[model samples]
Target: MPNIFSSLKNAYQLFKHIDFNQLDALSKKVDLPKMVETISSLDEKQLSAMMKMMGGNTKKKELPPIEGDFYHLGDEALKDADRELQLKVRAVLEKDVKPLVNRYWNKAEFPFEIIPKLAELNICGLTYQGYGCPGKSNLMEGILAMEMARIDTSVSTFFGVQSGLAMGSIYLLGSEEQKQQWLPAMQQFKIIGAFGLTEPEVGSGAAGGLGTTAKRQGNKWIINGQKKWIGNAPFAEVTIIWARDLADDEVKGFLVKKENPGFVVEKMQDKMALRIVQNGLITLTNCEVDEEDRLQNANSFKDTAKVLKMTRAGVAWQAVGCARGAYEAALKYTQTRKQFGRPIASFQLIQNHLVEMLSNLTAMQTLCFRLSQLQDQGLLTDEHASLAKVFCSMRTRDVVSRAREVMGGNGILLEYDVARFVADAEAIYSYEGTKEINTLIVGRAITGFSAFV
Candidate 1:
């Protein structure tokens, strides 16, 4: 009533310079109980004002949530139910997967325990129709890819091999009986699947120069060759081996079971990236498949490209997730870590690093969103998917590098989370199709010139 706020502020200023340790010693010579009681009796507003005065302009602005998707692309675009599912999946990854991921990454092992929980999500074959698949749009599938990869890229890779490459091969080209035989069980995680495409000497040029060969016998097709970097092949119950026909020189797909006598898988080791993914060097020494097990409609490399064209969009989404994960980790670290007696995030130079990371992340996310839209509309071409893959993978490298830079030395430590993304990005950059191959696909579309040669 009588300008009590001003009086309270002055009293707070008086107490501001008083050292609590020195005050404790001085209290022995004064009426300590009365002085403490007087200070404690201040009302809520008075106390807040007094604290503000004592703290001396320490009222920092509350920063918004450190979201990697600054443009709210996910929120603005996803339907209510899809958005809910997205968050639910993210919570599961954070609670169940994120806590245990680094340990598995260190050991280069898969957490088989998560298979049951992952199966419960019922997200396999997200875009395919029937055969226990979700039959959702490609957009949803892309989002789920991002969600899985946000926590562990290896798990995402495992899932992609099963759902996109292996299952997709069957879904797109197999006979109805084939889909019925594989999709339901694979969808439930009862049967794991791997895709074998790239050979040791035929990586980026695999589409044209597949070295794996399949020779037709009386009632069986005998496959012979090596497949390098076949994800999940080491443990997959079924591996879809792509081999060229000796008769017509056409590429064909075979569902090679793990117990096949002539099929051998050696676990690839000493990998510098995506260590948790069990990539295999698969050797097919006269691996025999019944004609019934052959992918019925897969007659040529074009059918195989159909599978790659579909999965390549998902790979682009995975790149976005990788970048988002790294950017978010770095942003949170910068906000709390202090340099020169202030939070490093408060500095302009550090803010510039953050902004650039966000810019790249946003660009990747938006591009993937559009790519998924095109896929959903049934307008997705190889060139469109390839362009997104190339752009997102290339930009993700930049984002992860910036993320590591912002964290200084801690960025390289596995415990920090970003180092894994940084390392995993290298694999994402190379796999599916290398940057050069994907760029050529897009290059041909824009200029109508085949630059792949």
Candidate 2:
């Protein structure tokens, strides 16, 4: 009896290794579980006869690896080098950044180790000419923004602050000498930068209601006031501080270095979204900057709007990435998770959720692609960006919500990846421009009436 038991155990172990496709084919005609149970109760002769009845010609079908970009937009659109760069960047985010992002996000701490590799990408000032910049098209810049936000939005925000808002201010408004002085090092990430425009009291209204004041005296400019939600300001080498000129009543941009005697930055804590972005409450109390540090061409608030115009489009792209990330995570989750003895993804209701997510995601990708194209052609308007921002941000909220819903209880947990997108979407919706503000921008363009007060 002991010998028979040992033989039966060995036979069952070998049967377990049989190709699933063969089992599936056999299952079409036979009651597999009943047959297995009956065979287990049979003598060795009966089991051998059953094994012979089943042919060994089954071959496994190799399915393509599951990927997020279902439409292959990324592969078809990007040039070979740009696509390679995108893959490299994605690899870094997947291997190094994604694994550690959730913990840092929970603790609201920035990951400093990835900075060197990020700097090596040489993507800073990607759309700018000269000054050690990559001088790529705005489309490439937008694509990179999407790539970053697809993994972690806080890091994307940090990069946007340094590369778009801060460097763009200098690139667009700085004098030739100012560009020569700052652009090279800043472009290489040797010196990090921040842009301070939003105040504690003013956010979307900053263009019209800037409370920070800058008074020029002799060759120095005295800037006084506070800036809130200033990303990267806590550790930035230099900050592009926007303050209303006391002399001319015009908005001006000043380069306030971190070591300035009167410049102080306190980290803002307890943020629910983009916590790893290192937002700061910056106080400029009698902070004096040399004339050379003032952005030479930033004569009015309109100049600051130029920088916003460029970065806002990138924000729209980020929204698409955030949605893509959540949708992909949810899609992957459904495939492996089992319920009722089958993959949850195989259910009709679950497939409906996936299709909805894919629909919104596809729309956002196409919208951002056109937005970037318009930007590259220098034909982009505030309304164009606002439309994309409004549509993508709003739809992203929906996509992430559905993504969470499909995952059942695991959706709300940070480890699942969908939860972060759900939280981060709020910040993206509000920043750059609020939904109402952006919608008003679009409304005014089509109707020829400014509804904003």
Candidate 3:
């Protein structure tokens, strides 16, 4: 040992300059004396190169940044312009909404200041063909939903209520004159809208029966009932209220103007989740809506189902964003949060959790992407949308939990962002349709059995 590399004085000199700690650690893993003896046969040039390789004699190479968008679906799946629009939407959210999200969530207040900033993007009714809307693909619309919820699901819910549900109702069921009247302003965000399908007594079973009733008079309809968990209802200019028509006993849609004397909304308070959203308990004390305000073609529950069918895909996309927000946040946290003098991200156990999150996130994303594609192809079914909604929402809950697990105590704090995601995932899970209800929807389609009572 000493007679081998010890005879080569120059190679032995390099070893003397090397850090003893590094040598000791390396020696624990390898036979350093024999290794140095073997390398001692190399010439001066190889010896210098070998010394530099073993030590940081040269600059360390930089990696191309690891991020949670693990697959560049935003960059690769979209066309040049569409991809830019996606980035632009993300930029707006990060600049305007992200900074205020935790603060607003803490105060349980809505940020009205960003309405014009969001409106300036002209994304409302993006899939609708007229009324100053962009008339984009369903995929683009879903992408926009994802972009919104990735930052804040409350904003996503707000946007989807306006762009997808409320406007979608009028677009799919509104008459020509009705579309002319509301679609243009709503498309421009001049009139914010809320959808009132879920009542205090009914949510999953709203399709079969509605507590809200509309009695037709000579020229108007009187709407009387209460709506719960109606997002944006407190400030919505027009709320699309679903009511049971007294004469027909069929579910009908009515555009109830906020100015209507009998229409009142009390802001819901002390919600454990989605606090940034302004959920309202709406009271309609004989809310008089003109016959024209009633969705003319909306004669039955089927008409309402059309809007839900389309919006369900967007809800699934929202879940994808929720999971993604958590995954990305957790991954970034792991890379920076040092444990044992190294990044927790470098730890095998932490990385296992990160990969699991990404896998679930990716599965959700690809599933939603295809679901939207089916929508664009005119091949989307209730079951298809339901399947995605059920799967994404359920998986999102798991993803966010893992995300929180990785962050330790900071995961539950609202200021840290992951906590909000964990809270919001609960809303997305139960809303649109509960897991059991959506499962039954899919089950009915495949088995020809109605599982719901």
Candidate 4:
């Protein structure tokens, strides 16, 4: 009697999904009563299988948590306080900077509003020892740099120019008075700064081939010629301009104030990547700077290279951030976007792309970790930084490319965020140092041959 009742219940449940009209149509062609009896005689396993065939299950599928740090580098490697700082920086960037980036990027304008918010983090001049700077490890600074670029590379570049290049010029080579006057305010983002190393005609060759000239006249120096692609130059209070001196025919650093009548900066436009950064074309027409304002110890281009070498490692970390951002966005998108009645992430090709991106990103992160360690130990050289820069930037381009490919049509749209990452990756590949230039730097170090002409 119990078996009879269970069979009857299963038959009733099956009838719920059947259309009565369709059942009537089938009744004329076949025996409906006999078919029902056969179905009723079936046990629980058969009934459950039939329901599944009819698409009865409606439960939401569970997916893994979305995280770009697949290796737990942040969790296992950093100490308690350091991990807390990392999370703090990530929280600020995700909350304050992420939402505004796509809009400003579309407009090709800097969101001036976020400056005070970022300044509140007090992370500027992160590795510097004094002058209100945080005396942190190079690893910490590199990690924070990654945090910034993860959200927006333009924001990272803006901060790097202020903290690493411009302030570093003063901190490393400036007189005591210069460091006292500039580092504190710049560290707090009170006075924005710009670095003028790349010119309209000179970029990688600026080490020895600078075209801008500085001619001294007793207590003052006249800086002439134009500097191009100078980040923050349009509105920075001070710019650390590198010019060839007429006396020694070597590179010299000058503290050129924006208010000076001879100094002029025009905004550069029509950029496709890192558009939020206010890159400027600077024209120094006999710009006179006080002798005291000059970087006292920046005697040659080698001094300038010191700043670049230190900051290039940070650029490598920024590349990792850019790749990580794209990878995470793509991963989340694939898990949610449905195709052929299932998540796209379930497809083998899509998963392959994701794993490749993760592999490249992990490699970059580990290399940068060791690179920063070398820097902290004072064992870092030009070739070390350049190697990381070349490898990470190249891999970033590949990761973003695969990220966009996985998103298909949605990848190119700014609404998806991957589009911005795709465009910005190109800029990272070219800037700091071009891939060919950096490869040669490594090639020279390993082969003991100077390939530069």
In terms of TM-score, which candidate is strongest? 4
Tens digits of per-residue lDDT for model 1 on 1-453? 344554465455546667889777877888855654565566667677767775645668797797877888888888998898888888888888898889999998888888888888888888888999888889989999998888878888988998999999999999999999999999999999999999999988877768999999998999999999999989999999999998998999999999987999999998878888899999999888999999999999999999999999999999998998998899889989998988999999999999998888888988999999998888999999999999999999999999999999999999999999999999999898889988888999999999766
Instruction: Using TM-score as the measure, name the better of candidate 2 and candidate 4.
Output: 4
What is the lDDT, from 0 to 100, of the residue 148 in candidate 3?
A: 93
What's the lDDT for residue 437 in model 1? 86
Write the number of the candidate with greater TM-score, choosing between 1 and 4.
4
Candidate 4, position 72, lDDT = 83
Displacement of residue 245 (Cα, Å) in model 3 is: 0.6
The regions of model 2 sitting more than 4 angstroms off are: 1-64
Q: In candidate 1, how many Å is residue 26 off?
A: 10
Q: Per-residue CA lDDT of candidate 3, range 142-251, in tens?
A: 99999899999999999999998899999999999999999999988899999999999999989888999999989999989999999999999999999999898999
Clashes of each: 0, 0, 0, 0
Best by lDDT: 4
TM-score of 1: 0.91
| Shift of residue 134 alpha carbon in model 2, Å | 0.9
**Which has the better TM-score: candidate 3, or candidate 4?**
4
Off by over 4 Å in 3: 1-66
Whole-model lDDT values for every prediction = 0.89, 0.89, 0.90, 0.92
Residues 1-453 of candidate 4: C-alpha lDDT, one tens digit per residue: 875676678767776776889667878998866767788788778888887787655567677898888888778768898889899989988998999999999999999999998889889999999999989999999999998888999999999999999999999999999999999999999999999989878988988668899999999999999999999999899999999999999899988889976999999999999999999999999899989888999999899999999999999999999999999999999999999998899999999999999999999999999999999999999999999999999999999999999999999999889999999999999999999999999999999999987
> What is the Å distance of residue 394 in model 4 from its true position?
0.8
The pairs that clash in candidate 1 are none
Model 4 has an lDDT value of: 0.92
For candidate 3, which ten residues in a row score worst on lDDT? 56-65
Residue 10, candidate 2: Cα error in Å is: 16
Residues 1-453, candidate 2: write the lDDT tens digits. 765575566457437657789678878998866655555576766655666565322455354465667778878888999999888888888888899899999999989987887898888899999999988988889889988999999989989998999999999999999899999999888899999999999898887869999998999999999999999988999999999998889999999999987999999989999988999999989998999889999999999999999999999999988998998899889888999988898899999999999999898998888888888888999999999999999999999999999999999999998999999999999999999999999999999999989
